[model samples]
Target chain A: MEKKVLLGNEAIARGAYEAGCHVATAYPGTPSTEILETIARDYREIRSQWSPNEKVALEVAAGASVSGGRALAAMKHVGLNVAADPLFTFSYTGVNGGFVIVNADDPSAWSSQNEQDNRHLARAAKVPMIEPSNPQEAKDFTKLAFDLSEEFDRPVIVRITTRIAHSQGIVELGERQEVPVKPFVRNPQKFVMLPAHARPRHVFIEEQHKKLKEYSNRSPLNRIEWGNKKRGIITDSVAYQYVKETCPDDSVLKIGMVWPMPDDVIREFAAGVEKLYVVEELDPFIEDYVKALGIPCTGKEIIPICFELTPDIVDRALNGKIKGGAYPKYETNPVPPRPPALCAGCPHGFVFTVLKKLDLHVNGDIGCYTLAALPPYSAMHTQGCMGAGIGMHLGMEKAHGPEMARKSVAVIGDSTFVHSGITPLIDLVYNKGTGTVIIMDNRGTAMTGHQDHPGTGKTLSGEETHTLDLELLVKAIGVKRVVVTDPKNVEELERIVREEVAAPEPSVIISKRKCILIK
Target chain B: MKNVIFAGVGGQGVILASKILMEVAKNAGYDVKESEVHGMAQRGGSVDCNVRYGDRVYSPLIPREEADFIVSLEMLEVMRKLEYLAPGGRLIVNTEKVNPAPVQTGAMQYPPDLREWISKNVKNALFVDTSGMLKEVGTRKALNIVMLGILSRDLEFTREQWESAIKSLVKEKFLDMNIKAFNLGREYN
Candidate 1:
């Protein structure tokens, strides 16, 4: 076997391929984006596509699974919230050919709006969850997740953090093991979740949970490493690596399977050590569970509940120096702050520059276009998650009337508009509100890397596909006035935008341009 | 084990330079691990990577004050990561100054005595005027490779090995110019 250095996300993609995944679908989000990108670029055997949003991505993968093909969906931690509607019920329906969902979490909110721990979601959804400490485990656990999903007849969640997802480590490559796809059976009772069938399916999910809990107790994934018997650290995922590096002599209970956590195994490990510490990032999820089992353990009190934990932080926390602030201190001159900015020739720059000159109240959405909030082009006023711009613009229009609303405009990317912007755009027309919606169609999802979307005219595997016409779509949704203009024509763009916003009728301006970095 | 910190602004190729070092270390048959920041931060923001190599590496992160060498692509980014340098650690810094967003927006000023302050603090600081060297090469993008060339002087890898690493990493179109820039950096005082 040849060894290759790989990022944790790349390793997960490799694991999915080697596990014989038939289809992979995802929407690009930090840390998790590369998983699908790697699969799309490297693995031609698997049919991979980037969905409009996380919710649609999960549904697409679910459809593949129900049709008797192994499927995987990848997204960032916050993206899970968008996909939660399908995920909560998918647990009850199980799968026909195995399903795996990768949730890349951010502990310090690095490159994200929040550092949400998705392990709780896995527990709430009653799905098996695996956490990998390094790139090697990232690969192995992904393959294991698919197998476990099929074995337990449920979808498995693989939770990763920024440190694990982006860090590089050596991994041994393996040949692809293609699993024969099972025939898709038309069983309405199992697949369809009309309240009547869902009632029985919920009971089946409960039964599966019980069996999984039993399986977790003796599973090889959760192992106990012997060291100094006095102190034992119970941790999983990236936190486990920090523990090992910081306290090498301490006994470790590395829980690879994070959910339905090997209760008996944990109890046995606790009994042997005089002192136990549950080390995990963000929420004290494992710490809370261990305490629930009547196990005395030290956690958040000493470790500090916020931010990503480094090896030095962990060591100082355990040694009681953290409270005294006994960390490395250096004397140096003050450095200039380097905040992220829009690229030199970014098409969004023109729109933002125009918006600032016009002094328009711009409602922004997620993606690289969000950078407009910074620096010389501080054009964006309100940015509230993905797909919120259109609705926020409509709400402001209805509350303040057309005179004030004419000064406000919603700015969103092409992919984001395809994601959740459609419903809100329709709302603008149905509610009889007059607000200008500027779809900054960069021709691709520029943020989290240029992954293909419905509007890109290409699939994730680089195959030419049907491209959505933003102008036609907006007009079809009952927006009487819709105009398409190139962002490069700054003079024309500013003139048209001014005219549309003051029209006293709902309108859309599709500012068309390709991302400078895409080519 | 040796810990190296490569620090610079986003577009300086700091990550790529560290990655090249990682590959060179791996080729030398030493266990290696590295960490880098990606995604939103890559847009002209301060970026750094930790590259550790030796018999074994448990953590990708280098502990505070544990870095054996600090390779800085920009002067200010060097100050930001000064805490990562071990006492008596070697510092190979490019004297190129990049005005960050605040300074460019006139909200902040670049510290005037940065070079004097670095000289007063560090004992083994080797400062090279990378911008001047790149002027000879006729391309500013080769600044990272030039800095790597200066750092290679203290490492155990042969000259051929360093050149081979550069050859593998740099694009074919710009290979000869980068090779020349690396050599010029190596010969600089």
Candidate 2:
């Protein structure tokens, strides 16, 4: 076994590469973006790109898979929400090639607007959700996930958290395999899951699930470690490590395969131990499933139902309150609290600071500038999702009246502007609203590890794509009042914001600056 | 040999400090493993990095109350992660404060007298005037690098090894300025 240190995301990418994945598509989101980035950069055999959105990414990957190639699609937890429309139906229409949909979950909202646990999606879609505890498991589980996908003729959700996605660990490397591409078996009855085809597949899915549960029980990924069998804890992902650290002596069942929990194994383990505690990040999926089987197990009751788990949290729950549970005390100085902020030289900082000075009611989109909604630069008014800024600004003008609405504007980053912001700008021009859209063009997708966007003239594989110029794009959208300003020039930004805020009709302002990452 | 946990909001360069430490330890020929959180590309959010060095490394994970060095780039984040430092561990902090969105929105309370709060809870701590150092260095952007310089003295790596690692990290254009920043940081302690 050749072991080399690799990022968790890179390891997953490597695993897919070595597994002979042929096509991979993803929409850039935190934790998940690097999976595609690494594949595009290092794995020449896989065709990869950042699709327009999560739904499109999954659809494209599905198409590739249907063509009898191993394919994968990736997105953040929220991105899955956007792709849910396709995901639910895709379960009915199984895959010809091994297809894996990667959901990189942000449990503690570390870099997300909201902390969403995606295990619910797997359960709702009736798809198996597999989570890896570390970089090694991340790679191994990915390979297993594809095999399960092909075996069941279904899509598998490879769920990962912030820690597993970003952490670096020594992983054993493997030689890339060469898999011959199979021709797509275009049987209308089998390929197309119409109500007629879906009924049998639906029944087939239930049978598949029963077999999957048995497979989950038999799989080596789900194993029981015997230390002390008195107090049992069943955990998965990073939480397994925490449980081991906190209660190393306890009989622990560390699950590498997270979802479609093995009920028989859990019942046997729960019966053997005096008390069992289920440990998982964000949700009580296993605990609830175990309890539903009439097995009394403690999970979210003793552990927090929110956020990621740590040794401290586990120690407090397992021992501190119950004697012999207190972790070793560490004396620390009570340092002051400091929150994150935009860099002093960050162009977005200046632009938002100017917007606050102008007292413009700025509708914000997602990006590093989301910080502008906080602190001294409290400029952003409403923030929902990407591209909502321009459309929301127009809606505000219609609701707040044309005269007062002239003070309304939408502030967004250039990469964000391309992601979903362009449609709203087109909507504004067509609907005729007295609103201004400020595009903070920071050359790079700064928040998601400085990956390039369509506007940056770079593709996911670093190949040049057709660069979408915001200026020309806005003009083409039929916006007449388009002005590009340097965000670093706070004075100019303030003046421009004021001018556009008082304008009689819809306008576009492009605040162009190179990102700090690029610099 | 000690495990250091760097905690701060995203964009505070907490990860960079850990990365620099990893570089120093690697250059010093000590076994080291550094783990950092990725995927916070949207806003200023919680971020942490773990740097461990010793005779041999088993896992990249850090346990509760096990960190020998606790670097607090942000105040609340420091308190949030203080439980990770082992007894007698050193706490290095930047005195400057930036509040989170919730605090600014009045949805959360901003802790008052951060140093005192930390001193009350933690046994040993060092406060470096990082904001002042950054201003004196003539670049607020260099605050993270400056803190690394201060950490350099506390690190186990030799001065030459540290310098060479830092030198190889950046372009030549900023080398002189960064050297000045590092020296200024070293002098702060």
Candidate 3:
């Protein structure tokens, strides 16, 4: 075994590859983008792509799994929210081949906009969740996730945090194991999941969960170390490693598969240990779960239900010997707030600056332009999830006539526009809402570390592929007034926004700018 | 023999310099666990890296307040990572100033004469003309490595190890240039 330093995202991709992942799909979001990208780039046997959205990603992976190929669908924490509808039903329909959903959670919004705890979704969907602590575990758990998925005939969620996804560590590489493609056995009663078949499948899913939990009780993934009985800690993922490092004297039950918790194993563990404490990030998922079994525990109360936990933070929370204020303190500087800004030379910067100069009520969508909501460019008055700007702008135009709408424009990132901006653009065109939708085509997705989307003429793994032209996409949607302009030219960009805002019909303006990081 | 943490904002070259130090230590045959913050945090954010060196390195994680040398590339980053340094340990700081996320957010106040400010707050501090040093060398990107060159005076790695590391880190095409830059930095101090 050779030890090579690898990022956690790359490690997970390697693990998926070693486990014979035939198909992988994901939507680009930070902390998780590299997982699919690395798989697509490094693993020649594996087929991977950046799906249009998280929902489509899940459906595509699910379709691949039904064809009897091991598949993986990855997304950030919130992307799960978009994919949850299919995820909930997939648990009932089950999988013909192993299907693992990698949810890279940004616990502190380190690379994300939200710090959502995703274990709730795993529990809500009755799917098992595996949390890995470091790069090595990130790889191992991914392989194990696929195995568990096939064994239980259900999709497993391998939940990882931002720290674990970005952190680098030495991982022992493993050999890839291939699976023969199975024939499509058409069993409509099992595969279709119609209401009639779903009821039985739901019961089967419950039984499968119990069997999996029973298996977990004896599984090597979860372990108990004998030590001082008092101050017993129940932790998983990185928290387990922190507890081990900080409170080594205390006995601990380290859990990897947090959901469908091994009831018998935990019950025995709690009975043997005293003063049970739970250490977890974001939520009291494990603490609450163990307590539900009538075992008393302290969690979130002392461990904090927010942000990541370091060894120092864990030591202090556990009332250990770590000195007070020993950890890195948050910055305390009273300067003007510059929540990330568009670079000085950014092409999009000029366009937003001009839009603000024109005093246009710009509804902005996600991307680098979202930074326009801040400083010198404060052009965006409203910004939300992908494609919301167009919808919000259409609503504004419908409420207030064309003259009023003339002062408003919807600005969206080109990649985001393709992802969800089409529906709103169609609404504006068919329903006669008069407002300009600026598609900020920054070539690559600048915000989430410059991953390629539909418009970049590249695939998820930086391959040369057919790039979707935004102008053609807009024209196909029947938008009459579509224009492209270099965003660096502020005068031209502002003139276009003002002119399009006054146009009577739905219009689209593709503000062409190569992302600063990419270029 | 000791751990050092270099905390700074993105583009401050803290990561590159820390990597240079780690590489130097490794070339000197000392075990090293170097941890970095990759992906999102590197884009104009408060970024820091850890370098733990000894005969044996147990884990990649460095304990809080255990760092023997704190090399701060930006002022507020020093304030942010002050606890990492031992109370009586030396702080090598660049007099250069850059606002951190909190400062830019108007949530905190930027300290004045940041090097002196940290000296006032910390137990032992040394202020260095990193900006001037890099300018004298005719390259702004080498500021952190130059600061690290200044640090090599008190550290374990020999000048030869530092030179070897610079050779290893930079691309082959520019290796000779970076080695000259590193040698200039080593000679200045």
Candidate 4:
């Protein structure tokens, strides 16, 4: 095996490839997007795809698994909220071959709207969770996740944080193990989630949890290292590295499997050390679990419950030093802030510039266009998560009536519309609500490094597929008035926007242009 | 162990410079780890990466005031990450200035006395004329490689190793120009 430097996400992709995963699906969200991308770029054997959104991604992967093919779905922490519907049911339905869900958590809200810990979701959904510390572990554990998923007959969640996801480390490469796909067996009682079928499956899920807990206790992933008996630290993922670096003298209990936490193993380890501390990022999930087992542990109270943790933080916290005592504050004036901006020649910039001139309240969706909320072209007024723009635009129209609603428009990107905007656009047509939608068709998912979506004429594997026509799709959804106009034509765009918003019926102005950054 | 911080605005190739450095360090048989900022922040925002290499690296992050090297691609970004530089640490900075949104919008001004302030406050600060050097190469895109060239002077790696790292990473069309840029950086005062 040759050692190569790999990002943690790339390592996960490598792990999936080595595990003989036949299919992989994902929606481009930071810290997790690269997993599928790397697979698509590097591994030709596996079929990789960028689904419309996280929910659809999960369902696609789940469908592959039900067909007895090894599958993986990757997404960020918040994306789990979108995919939670399939995730909970998939937990009960179990798997035919194997299924692994990669959750890249952002503990400090770095490049994210929220700092959510998806470990709770793993526990809630009654699925086992694996946390990898570095790039090497990321690869090894992803392979292990598939094996555990098949053994337990359920999906596994492999969680990682921003630091681990983006960080680069050496990983030993291995050959792909071609696991033969199992024949798809039609068992309604197992696959179907009706009232009667789900009732028994719930009991089976509980039984699976018990088996997982026992497996967690003995799994090679969970191990204890001896150092100073007086002090012990319990940690996992990237935090384990910090604890190891900071408290090299202290005994460490590194938990690779975070959920269904090895109670017996934790109890045994806690009994050997005089003082135990849980060092984890974000929530004190392990600390709470340890305390519930009637064990005394120091966490969150000593370390912060907010933001990402570092070696200096861990050293200062345990050494009884006050926060900020670990290092000297350098004497320097604060630099001017450099907030992200729209590209110089971006088509969205032109659209926003026109909207700014119009002085209309533009409801925005997530993507590169979200930057329109900032700077000289502050055209967008409100932005909720993906696909919320159309719904919010409709709500604002209904609340203020058609008179004020004429002054508002829903702005969404091409990829974002494909993600979750289409359904809401239909709601506008069906309910007879008059809300103008400005679909910023930039020809790709421009925000997260230009991954292909349904609207883009390419698949994740870079194959030329059917390019969705946003104008036709809007028209097909019963939107009476649809106009496709280039945003570069400022005069024409301004005129069309004003005309559409003034019209009584539902209207869509497709701001058609390619992303300036996309080659 | 060596901890280096590379700071610059998005599209300046700070991340690529770090990657090249990490590869060089790894080729030298040292364990290396790097932390980078990606996604939304790459849209002309302040971006940075931490590259640490040694016998063993446990944490990718470099604690405040502990970095041995601060290689900044832009002047303001250097000021923002100045706290990461340890006492007696080398600050290899590009003289280029990228005006942030506030400065561009006329809400704020680029600090006029940045060079003087840095010299007075820091003992070992080297400001390389990146734009002037890249002018000879006829491209500003090679500025990062030029900066990396200057940084290579202070590192333990050889010229061959640095060149090889660049060869493996840089696209073939731009290879000769980047090599020239690297040489220009290495020869910089």
Candidate 5:
């Protein structure tokens, strides 16, 4: 076996290659973005593609899986929310080929909008979730997740946090196990999701869950480590490393299959120790499970539920060295905050400057344009999730009427427009809403490091592809007015926006420019 | 375990410098774990990475007041990371400074006399004045490697091992220039 230092994201890609994953799809988001990127860059055998959004990414992987080929899809935590619709339904339908979805959660909101614990999503959807603690497990668990997915006839969720996604560690490499595709047979009840099929499928899911829990009791993934029996800590993912480092003397149950928790092992370990503790980041998923099992455990009671945890925080909390879970104090001056900003010469900078000058209420969506909500060009007033701004603007126009529409504009990046913005633009037009939707067509996805989307005319693999025409897209969707102009041309663009918003009709403004960082 | 941090503005090659050190440490048979925050965090924001190498590295992050060394490419950036530095940790500062948005837009001022502050507060601080060195190094982008070269002085690795890492990681087209930049940094008087 060959060993090399790899980023956790890289290890996930390496695992996919080793598992002989044939198809991979993803929409770029922080922490998760590098998974698909590495797959595209390193694994020549894997056909990786960037879907418009997480939903589309999952559905694309679903299509590949049903066709009897191993498939994988990955996205950040919030992206899972977008893809949850299919994820919930797909869990019941099961899989013809091994399928895995990598959900990389951001703890402490580092490079994310929120630090959501996705194990809740995994449990809510009743999908088996495999969590790895570091780069080595990130590779090993991901490779094993595929086999588990096929054996159980279900889609597996490989849940990770920023610690496991961005952290780097040594990983031992293995050979590719190319499993032949299982032959697909046409079965209406299994493939199609109707009331008749879904009703029984729901029962099938419950039955599968029982077997999974039984497997969890026996699966080597959920192993117990022998240590001092004084303090028993049940932990998973990157928190296992923190627990091992800080509370080395404590007996531990490190659960790899976090969704179908090893109930028997958790109780056995709790019985073997004096006191039980649960060390997890974001939410008290394992803690709640241990308590439900009638095993008394201390978790968020003393541990700060907010932000990410470290060895110091865990050590202090376990020993009662800190009161009220106060963060460790450091004697240092309050340095000037270096908040995220639009890059100098960023195309969005010009548009935000113009909007600020006009004193208009800008409803902002995700991407680099979200930086407009910050200092200097505090133009964006209402910032929400992807595509929410477009609809929010439409809602304001419908509620407050023409004058409000004239005073406000909805801004979204071209890539985001492709993600979830198109439907809202159609809503504005179909419902006869009056507002200006500014598509900041910066030629690529800028915030997540310039991954190409539909509008960029380039695939994730840097192929020359068809560029989606933004102007035609809006106009074809019943928009009467669509203006394509240079965002940097402040005076001319300002005049166009003024005219479009004053007109009592839906309009689209395509602010055309390439991101400054792009070559 | 030795905890090293590369602190600077987003585009200062902090990740690259950390990666090079990680590679060298790995080659020298030490377990290393490095952590980085990119994505929107790299949009002209403060970006830093932790590089921990030892017989067995546990946490990729360096707890507060535990960093063994902090090498920064900017003045204020290094100051921001002072909390992570141990009381007796070495501080290597690049005299160059990239003004944060608030400082650039006049909302706040970049902390003044950082050199004086470092001299008084830190037990050991080495300020690398990049102005004269950039002329000899021939590029500003190589300042990261230069910072690594200065870092090489305090580390246990041989100069040849460091050069081998640079050769493996850096593209051959720019190998000669990067080697020169690294040497100029290593031999800086």
Candidate 6:
């Protein structure tokens, strides 16, 4: 085995290669974007591509899995929300070949809108979830995830927080195992999820969970460490690393396979110790499960569940004090904050400057353009999730009148426009409402490290492909007037926006400019 | 165990410096774990990296007041990460202030007498005057490599190891310039 210091995301990609995954797909979102990028760049064995959005990514991977090939779809926690439709049903219609989805969560909203706990989603869907503590487990557990998914014939979710996804450590690398793909047979009862077929498969899934729960109890993923019998701590994922370093003397159960609770193992460990505590981050997922098992465990009550846990924070929670005396760093002067800003030559800033001048209530979508909402150009007023701007603009127009459309405008990125913006734009047109939507056609997903989108005319692997025509597509949606212009020409953009908002019909302004950061 | 932080603005080459440090640490048979902020938070923001090295490192994150060294590429960045410096920890700073967006826009003023604050508060601080050195290098980006050179003095690593690490991580065309910057950084300490 070769030893190398690899990031947690790189380890997952390494595991994907070693497990002989056939298809890899994703929509770039940090702390998880590198997983698909690594596969596309280094591993030629796997056919990897970027889908328009998370839903398309999951569907692409799902298609590969049902056709008897191991597949992987990795995304941030919010991206999972986009793919939840497939995730729920894929549990009932189990996999012919192994399928794993890496849900990378951001605690403290580091690069996300919310630090949502996705382990609950795994429990809700009755799908088994695996989490790794470090780069080493990030590799091993990801390899194990594919096997567990195949064993239970279900799509597995490997949940990871930003800490685990971004941290780099020494990992012992192993060779790739070219596992043969299972043959697809004519079995609609198992593969197809119509109401008639899905009902019994639901029962089949319930029975499988019973067997999976039994396996969870005995699975090597969940291990118990015997230390002092006085204080017992139950934890999973990166939090397990903190618990181990903070309270080495305490008896602890490290839950690697996060879902199913590993009931028998949990009960066995709980019976061996006193003053049991569950240590986790963001949410009390394991704590809630342990309590429902009728086991008295203290969690979230004392241990704060706000952000990621460090060793000292874990010690302070577990032992009622810092490991060492906490030294107060500063006394009088407060350090000024250094917030992120758009690049010096950013095209988005120019458009937002015009909007600020026009005094339009801009509804901004996610991307580098979101920075326009900040100082120097406080143009954007309301902001929401991906593709939320267009619909919210429509809602405003509907409640108010055509005057509202003239007063306000919706702004979206090219990647997000395809992600979820199209349907909403169609909704605006079909409802006979007038709302001016600005599509910042940067030709790449700039916010998440410039990954290729459908509009970029390139696949995830850097292969040339058909570029989706944004202006034509909007016109086809029955948008009466569409104008394509450059934000660099600031005066004309201002004139165009003023003209479009005044028109009674729905109008689309495609501010086409290549991202400056992209070479 | 050694915990070092490279703090600077986003475009200041802090990430590349941290990577080179990790490479040097690994070359000296030390296990290294480096973690840095990415995504939306790092777009020309206060970017800092936590790099820990030892026989067997457990936590990639350094708790407050545990950093052995804090190498900064800009003047104000050192002040921002002062809390992470361990007692008697050595600080290597580039005595150059790249204005943050708010500062540049005149909403906030750049702290005056930053050098005075460093001298009064820090027991051992090496303020690297990269003005002339940056001129020779013909770019401000190589300042990170220069800061890395000063940091290399405090850590237990050989010159050959440093040279090899820089050579391996850096591009072929820019190797000579980065090596010159590294050597110029060593001339101070």
Every candidate's DockQ is: 0.55, 0.23, 0.31, 0.60, 0.57, 0.55
Sorted by DockQ (best first), the order is 4, 5, 6, 1, 3, 2
Report the number of clashing residue pairs per model: 0, 20, 8, 0, 0, 0
TM-score of every model versus the real structure: 0.95, 0.82, 0.90, 0.97, 0.97, 0.97
| Candidate 2: Cα lDDT at A446 | 82
Give each candidate's fraction of reference contacts reproduced: 0.63, 0.29, 0.20, 0.65, 0.67, 0.53
lDDT of 2 by residue, B5-96 (tens): 88777676776667667766755656666667665423566778888776655346677668888777766677677767777778888877
Determine the TM-score of chain B of model 4.
Answer: 0.97
lDDT of each: 0.88, 0.79, 0.79, 0.90, 0.88, 0.87
Candidate 1 vs. true structure, TM-score: 0.95
- Tens-digit lDDT track for model 1 on A266-379? 999999999999888889999999999999999998876788888878888876533321123334445567888898889999999899999999999988888898878988
Runs in model 4 lying further than 4 Å from the true structure:
A320-334
lDDT of 5 by residue, B1-189 (tens): 999999988888999899889989999999999898888667888889999999998788887777889999988887668878877889999988788888889877777766776777787889889777778878888889988988998999998999999998899998888888888888887
- lDDT at B85, model 4: 84
Which candidate number maximizes lDDT? 4
- The candidate with the higher lDDT, 4 or 6, is 4
Tell me the deviation in Å of residue B61 in model 2. Answer: 5.1
TM-scores for chain A over all candidates:
0.96, 0.92, 0.94, 0.97, 0.97, 0.98
Writing each residue's lDDT as its tens digit, candidate 3 over A1-519 gives: 765556688999999999999999999887788898789779978899988899999999999998798999999998898899999999898888899999988876766667989999999999988888788888999999888888899999999887778765557899999976667788887789889999999999999988988888888778888799977888887777678767879888889888878888788888988789889988888888888899999998888778877777887889756664643344453333324556657777777777877888989887777767765566789876777888898888778767767888888887888788899899888888878888878787777777788788888767788888889878988898999889877777777877887778888888887877775
Predicted chain A of model 5: TM-score relative to the true chain A? 0.97
Residue A168 of candidate 6: its Cα lDDT?
A: 82
Model 6 alpha-carbon miss at residue A88, Å: 0.5
Please give, for residues B108-143, the per-residue lDDT of candidate 6 as tens digits: 777786777787788878887888877887887788
- In angstroms, the error of model 4 at A408 is 1.4
User: Rounded to one decimal, what is candidate 4's iRMSD?
Assistant: 2.8
Task: Give the Cα error of residue B25 in candidate 6, in Å.
Answer: 2.5
| Poorest 10 consecutive residues by lDDT, candidate 5 chain A | A322-331
Best-fitting candidate, scored by DockQ? 4
